[model samples]
Target: MVSDRMNSRAALWRVAAGQRGYFTAAQALRAGYSYQTQRYHARRGNWLAIDRALYRFREFSDLPAEGDEQLVRWSLWSKGSAVVSHATALAAHDLGTANPSRIHLTVPRGFRQKSDAVILHRAELAEPDVEDRAGYRVTTPLRALAEYAADGEDQDVLDGAVAEALEQGLVTRRKLLHAAQALGARAELGVERALGAML
Candidate 1:
């Protein structure tokens, strides 16, 4: 019985191993931890609460500063339904001149969680518009650019982003045009001008 309990705890650690040592209450339950057990661990300083339902194993509290683990943690907190988007996605893809202070995430239109640390946009994202970046889901570079442009990002910033994306071959002209068109008239006009300047 003791061996079985130890194995279950080990399984929980394995589950958190891939997520920078973070895990959700639901995952802990699946790994045989009751709510009481979870609280005991937290009280014992073996786990750290990241949010209402998210936690990190104390052993991995010293993660590197440069990785997207926090973003991935937020996405997991969203139950995998949100994709990093807009300026945040631009930075993730390294395709644009974006430097967002807050993480931006796009969830389906009905997602209700709100946080001061996260900028949430509600939208329906097509599968093609989403991609995996460092294990986190994010809007593709062209899709992110179109969304950023449609949201009235600064013209100079938009232009620079478009130029950099084009220069880096992160997006082709046709795909950019298509994404722009999907964002409607204002975005199309802006993208056209940016493309013209690049040409």
Candidate 2:
């Protein structure tokens, strides 16, 4: 029984490691924690309940966490179907001029969930459009800027972010243009306007 418990802890740790120490109740159940066992662990302070159906290990972190934990939480909350996007992705790549107050997430076109904490964009994404962040996913810099333009974000912010991304080698000029062209007329025009101003 002791060995079984240890093994469960090890498995749960592996799962939480990829999520900045956050895990869902479903994950705990899969890790061999029964409902009663979970309650016992929670009461004993071995696990800290951070949100509805969500938990973090007591020893894995200090109080007052950072943005990475928030990203992990929402990614898990979306059942891993969403990617950090728009202004949030721009900020993550250090490419934007605007300090957006809300976190942005991109879900599939079929996704129907709503949340006040996140501004969600719905579209089907090709595999190459997403970049893995170890604990979560985000749109690539080129894609992020293009999506911003497509959505009619402030042109100044788009121009600044695109220029910064290009200057920092986060995206190639050719690929940036190509992605914009593929997004739509609005996105392509916005990108063209930004690039034209540079010349």
TM-scores of the candidates are 0.91, 0.90
Worst lDDT 10-window in candidate 1: 59-68
Tens-digit per-residue lDDT, 1-199, candidate 2: 9999999999999999888888988999999999888888888888988777788888767756665678888888888999998888888778868568888999988887777899998888888999999678999888998888888878999888888888888888788888988989999899988887677
Which residue pairs come into collision in candidate 2?
Answer: none
Which residue pairs in candidate 1 collide?
none
Misplaced by over 4 Å in model 1 are none
- How well is each residue in 52-93 modelled by candidate 1, as lDDT tens digits? 878998878876656678887888889888899988888877
lDDT of each: 0.86, 0.86
